[model samples]
Target: MNREPLVSVIVAVYNQERFIGRCLRSLLHQTLSSEKYEIIVIDDASTDRTSYALELFHDAIRPVANARNLGLAASVNRGIDVARGSYIVRVDSDDYVNANFLHMLSIFLEMNGYVDAVACDYLLVDDGENVIERVDCSERPIACGIMFRKEQLIDIGLYDESFRCHEDRDLRIRFDKKYRVYRLELPLYRYRRHDSNITNNAEAMRQHEANLIRKHGLDLAASNGMS
Candidate 1:
């Protein structure tokens, strides 16, 4: 396996006019060689300045606008379909990751042969983009903000269109059951929290989370019928 890998950073945006530009700025300003990696941003039919904002980075970004909003998974799948890189990533439209996010994560994936996926801790930022707290999550089946083989992603049937949120968690659970997922306890992703952000929509987000858990039948205890 090669020690240094090229990555395709994918971002799916829907009605995120306020945060899309900032998110792209961080990705576009990465320290990695621009020639090695490229940014693929899908606007997903946002009814705002998203397309206009995307036009600003036409030289560095592959922006795709839909005739109508296709939701998250569909938009992401479209980008992945055309991704030329060996590795693929999913970055939320409303959040901005650290500059070294891809560089550090890719190096680790290259170093570990058994690791099928890679994820790191993230910084929680508020609506104003102020850092609220930092979480050092070191556990199995890491969340998104990962750099891994796109083949594994395809093998798992890609993102579940049934879920608008918590799809990543469900994907992780199913994927990890068959593969070893590694975690790097570093704040590489900046997860933004705002009234407009998906997670902050308490009612909807909770419903999505519950839907994921219920659909997967995540039971802790098993009943034995044998004597």
Candidate 2:
């Protein structure tokens, strides 16, 4: 591990023992050379056997355990702080990716130096890994699948920890103001939908959405009025 990795994949997990194994497996089996990328898993004080699952791949990953549940944004920020790669990306513990995920995205960044970040399309999958739909990330963006320059992320300041929900949205808004995120139309990421998804909580999503709108001074009503 003497040479610096080209990319760092940060995984933030909370009680996702059932699917984390699959997620890590996909990352481990990436087409990208093993030495070119690093995997960092943040265990956000899960009350389940997630830690045990992490231990199974102890030799392959760098594990960081939080003493208490610090929410998603905070955990991601922690990962970013410790990452040594030139580029970084988040892969949720419940979702996995294609073998070419890292290689494709990293190559895109390498070839296009002006682009601050790049995101790929993804497939919506059920718990049984059945494909539901192929989603265009630019139209319906999610937290994962986007590879960003580590320095650019630090330049704009990291994720807003106050946002427990829609934190990705919040980060994107700020990121877009100063940098560009291009889209690579490839369904390389698999986003798993389940009953336990945080987005399932309508009330929390609403509160966070309102907070984001106000924080950014977005005039949603006016923008919609023209339509």
Candidate 3:
């Protein structure tokens, strides 16, 4: 009998052929036993050799190839829809993590059941994997490097499909309303900063930021008691 995984790590990819292999290898080498976790890789209709790179790990990961490009939000949601784990986490195809990343986060969540989610500090890195600076998740929470109880995510309606960028902020708003995200303050995850980063798109980010502010402005303001 095959026991269900305790954690589901969703690796969302676009056209990251250069980094996908390393990302997958990092997850595969986690200190957490293979049987205790599952890795789901969703390719968002990449035009590069990303698909071929994924093919190399077909046996190690559960792969999903979208017929069309649906952006990050949709791809993440798709991964969640099919996830079969008690806890859920995400790792971008362009990024990787330390060996104990999953083990530590999952253990923390298991021991502290009162928390809705657990996040760790991450190191921002260049394309060559050189450390740029360590980001304190206590100050700003990025999308990755966090683990959430699957049920809690479902209750909050998961990631908003309407958002292409800053979806993490939007979800955080809704998530903070009912529960809290605890930061471990440990540099366990690596965040890649490259020239092709989607956030570099100034106009798209501006439009999405405005859209998020518009959609949840009233709620956010009301929560802060701004009248």
Candidate 4:
């Protein structure tokens, strides 16, 4: 019998009532084995209709609610703690995936068995769920559609909660230190871009990213393999 769920998809939500439903819908409709993957929705003390929307799929999806409103970093780590899958995925509640999102991701991870994480290309969607632009991130990996190995994360100390927004960047540096990663050449997600996106808060996000680099004592020479 197969003992491992291929992917554990975690979507951390705050007050994203408007987009969470669409995001969940995309995940539920993925052309992947429903039994071989699990979808985790973490409602970070959202004071919006996000919870009611989540209940619509509570029978199918796993929902975790926090006691108080923790930030995104803390919330996603919560999902990681309970994830039962061998491989993991971190998606935002405001983003949606393609129909074969998990299916394609599973294929790539299985293809590159030695890699600790897989990052795929994505499309930028608008509030109306219409594609505004296609973002090909195969050249540069970000967290939006990143697929990771569960054990790798546990060994490297999951996402750093200190930096509120650039947690993904921090994890990338750490993961790259000990393991290889694959940049899959598939566009398998619809990364919704809106005014409320965490990256949209340029100042705060940049500060967090800089701090993460400095806090970890990371240098360009090391990450780039330069002498």
TM-score of each: 0.87, 0.96, 0.95, 0.90
Best candidate, TM-score: 2
Candidate 2 Cα errors over 4 Å, as ranges: 220-227
lDDT minimum window of 10 residues, candidate 3: 218-227
Write the residue-wise lDDT of candidate 1 on 1-227 in tens digits: 43333788889988887888899899988877777687889888888787888888898888777788788878888888778777887888888888888888888887877789887888878888789888664432223487768888888888887777666676766676677567788898988777675655668767776776676664510110000
Off by over 4 Å in 4: 1-4, 221-227
Per-residue lDDT over 40-97 for candidate 4, one digit per residue giving the tens place of the 0 to 100 score: 9999999989889899889988999998988888899999999999889988888888
lDDT of 2 by residue, 1-227 (tens): 38999999999999999999999999999999999999999999999999999999999999999999999999999999999999999999999999999999999999988889999999999999999999988888888999999999999899999999888877887788889889999999999999999999989988887887788766642221110
Computed on alpha carbons, the lDDT of every model, listed in order, comes to 0.75, 0.92, 0.89, 0.81
Candidate that beats the other on TM-score, 3 or 4, i.e. the better one: 3
Question: Model 3, residue 36: displacement in angstroms?
Answer: 0.5
Give the poorly placed runs of model 3, Cα more than 4 Å off.
218-227
Prediction 2 global C-alpha lDDT: 0.92
Count of backbone clashes for each model?
0, 0, 0, 0
Tell me the deviation in Å of residue 197 in model 3: 0.8
Q: Give the CA lDDT, 0 to 100, for residue 163 in model 3.
A: 89
